[model samples]
Target: MANPQKPPTAASKSSALASGKLGQIIRLLQRAKGATIDDLTEVTGWQAHSVRGAISGQLRKRHGLAVSATPDASRGLVYRLPKAGGTR
Candidate 1:
């Protein structure tokens, strides 16, 4: 008989984030131009509110990341992570 598969552990779940939508969003924000809520929502198939919540609750609070927002004529609000040693 075949062996039963094991459930995902904490390590596995965390590792999955490295390649999941959240990871992709992080990479997008790390770019020079950063990204907007529409961009994140389109990429992740999440609503605008969910994207904001993820940025605030997950990336900012849980991960201790500093995310900033600035006005953009074309994209509404652009979000990005400030450079190391830089103020948010």
Candidate 2:
């Protein structure tokens, strides 16, 4: 049997936040010019509110990234990196 108390592996962590998965979502939105909560939700398979929380809380607060959304466009808003990379 596996060790229950062992920490998660790097592979697991990467999978959870892989570019192909979450990174791709962010990249697509950035490259798309912008995207709405709905667009992020569709691509990430997350709910709109969850996407909002991740954008606001996780991306903005935690990662020092920015994601914006508006009501008019099909994609909604855009995401951009800070002029200087954030505090990691």
The candidate that achieves the highest lDDT relative to the unseen native structure: 1
RMSD of each: 4.5, 5.1
Clashing residue pairs found in predicted model 1: none
- Candidate with top TM-score is 1
Query: Pairing residues by index, what is the TM-score of model 2?
Result: 0.55
Where model 1 places Cα greater than 4 Å from the true spot, the runs are 1-15, 83-88
TM-scores for candidates 1 onward, in order: 0.73, 0.55
lDDT of 2 at 7: 90
lDDT of 2 by residue, 4-65 (tens): 78798868765665455467556655653456565677788988777777777766786556
Go through the candidates in order and give each one's C-alpha lDDT.
0.87, 0.61
**How many clashes show up in model 1?**
0
Q: Show the lowest summed lDDT stretch of 10 residues, model 2.
A: 79-88
